[model samples]
Target: MILCCGEALIDMIPAPVQTGGTGYVPHSGGAVFNTAVALGRLDVPTGFLTGLSKDLFGEQLRETLGNSRVDTRFCILSDRPTTLAFVRLTDGHATYTFYDENTAGRSLFPDQLPDLPDEIGALYFGGISLISEPCADFYAALAMRDADERLIVMDPNIRAGFIRDEDRYRARLDAMIRRTGILKVSDEDLEWILPGPGPLDEKAGAIAARGPKIVIVTRGREGAFASFSDGTMVTAPARRVEVVDTVGAGDTFNAGVLAALASDGLLTRAGLEEIDGPRMKSALEHGARVAAVTVSRAGANPPWSHELSGPDPD
Candidate 1:
């Protein structure tokens, strides 16, 4: 099982009303949550670990996860309210105003973390969960705890605006990256992490030096690029599809990559270290294909195994 650790929240997206003005609609989202759901839909044995509220929005999130077949037994339930992010989409791009203070996901502590079962072969960490306080530290601790055993994957999905303290967030991220076996970042995320005038690979290499064995950078329509610790590099072009909204595209892409890795029996730490050019390229293509289906639809809705072409990941 690939156990994803992070936030599960409600995205209040703008919807058109018959009365002329726009109204927001609740959508089950959050980067880590989206990826977990996508993986489950792709027929991967997936589990999600996060702090969940008993609120109505939390119920929606739980239902969504259940429908997608993502195990939620590891979730820590609380009476705290669910975090809400009001989204504004400009030409299919999304920006968020998060109401996250004191929310269930943000209030999680290190002590609340559960012992993992041997079935969990991989552990994924990221999203706004890495930006907040005590919970952020808790996730960082979890990653470090299992760093030597399970395959650790992370996609910082950096949301700079959500970061209250840059210094602390950077330190936490740096520590997590050092333990991350596979690290996926967007073009914007790469820039923010390094922030300089240089070639993409050069910046990605700097990040690779920190510890991640494999580094993947997703460039929206241009596709994705990956560099391995052994100096092997591969690229995949984005799949063409009519635009809906970019929300959850990157998250779904991460799911595809993980699913492909698992399908090829490369999801283990040793397998990732031994992965080659052809296999790496195949994974990238698979990721792009899966993400295409997501962007072609609205919200963070991902395609089921039957909805995608070729064989299922299982």
Candidate 2:
């Protein structure tokens, strides 16, 4: 089972066609939430660990999770309201403006964490959780406390505006990277985290030294590249598609990679470190294929397992 921990919230997106031609529409969103839903759709045994509100929005979010077949036993319900994010898409890219200062998901404390199952093959962490307060520390502690035999995946999904302390954020990110076995980052994320990069190899090398066995750098529509601790490097071209939006492409890609790894029985800690050329390539290809499907869709909705099967299997 894969346990995805982080925020779960509603995203206000632009309507397909504005009446007056100026406003946004609402959709269910959040990084880990998207990943969990995608995994569930792929028929992967997935669970979500996060705080939800007793309010209507939270109830709706819970229903959404249930519809996706994601186990929500670890979800905590509180008096706090569910978080909200306003997403704006332009030129096929999506940006978010969040309103989660004191939302339920951000209220997660270390003491509230559920006892993890011994059969958990992987744990995924990302998004605003790493930038928030008590929750941030809580997630970091969970990553540190988990046995090294479990696969740990992280995607920072950095938002510069929300971050108050740069040094503290960098320190936390660096520390989290050290604990993660799989690190998926975007070109924007790299530029934001590590400025001025003449050679991406140097940046990838620096990330590898931080303890991640595999570091994936996504280059939007261009493609993605991966570097393994064993000195294996592979690259794949992004599948061409008429993109509706890129809202949850990265999160969907994360789901695809984890799903592929889980299906192959390689989502364990030892499995991560033992990944070789063929395994890494297959994982990356799965990620790319899933992401392509997401881009071809409207919202953050990823394809189901059957939808992902192509005429010619790679």
Candidate 3:
């Protein structure tokens, strides 16, 4: 199983009302959560690990996971409230104003972390889970504990505004990065984490030195590229589709890449190290294909494995 570890929250997005202008509507979202949902829909045998509240919204989130077929066996339940993020989209890009004080997902601690089951083959980490408090450190400890065994995939999905202490967040992120075997990030994320004067590959190479054997940099509509420390590189262009909102595009893209890797029997530490140009291109194409369905939709809703197949003969 590919066990994703991170935040699960409610995204209140602006919606058109039946009789007037607009109102915010709740949706099950969070970068990591969306990826897990996408992976499950793609029949990836995925599971999610995070702190969950017993609140109404939390129950809704849990149900969404169940409906999507993502296992929630590792979720830590509490009476704490669920985190909420108000999303505003401008020209298809999303910005968030979060209300996350003392929430269940934000309050997790290292002591509450569950033991890694022997069945989990790949582990994923990223998003706000790498920025918050004791939970961030807990995730770091989790990563370090299994670094030598399972395949580790990470996407820092940095939101600079959410960070309260830059130094501490960067420190925690660096630790996780070193343990990551497959590191996926957006172009903007690469810029934020490696903010300096250098070529993109140079910056990527520095991060590769820290740990990862395979590094994927995604450039929205232009598609994504996968590079290795040995200098192997492959790029795939995004599929064209009418825009809706770009909320879960990247997360679904991550799911696609992971699913592709797993299907090709290339989801292990050795497989990542031995990845070549053709295998890397196949993964990138899968990510692009999956993400195309996401951007063409209304919200963060991802396509099921059946929906991802090409349309019946038109």
List TM-scores for all candidates, in order.
0.97, 0.95, 0.96
**Segments of candidate 2 deviating more than 4 angstroms:** 16-19
Give candidate 3's error at residue 17 in angstroms.
Answer: 2.8
- Prediction-by-prediction clash tally: 0, 1, 0
Error of 2 at 106 (Å): 0.4
RMSD per candidate (Å) reads 2.1, 1.7, 1.8
Note the residue pairs that clash in candidate 3.
none
Angstrom error of the Cα, residue 47, model 3: value is 0.6
Candidate 3: C-alpha lDDT: 0.89
Error of 3 at 69 (Å): 0.8
lDDT of 2: 0.85
Model 2: residue 141 alpha-carbon error in angstroms: 1.1
Off by over 4 Å in 3: 311-314
Worst 10 residues of 2 by lDDT: 16-25
Summarize candidate 1's per-residue lDDT along 90-156 as a digit string, tens digits. 9999899999999999998887778999989899999999999889988998998998989999999
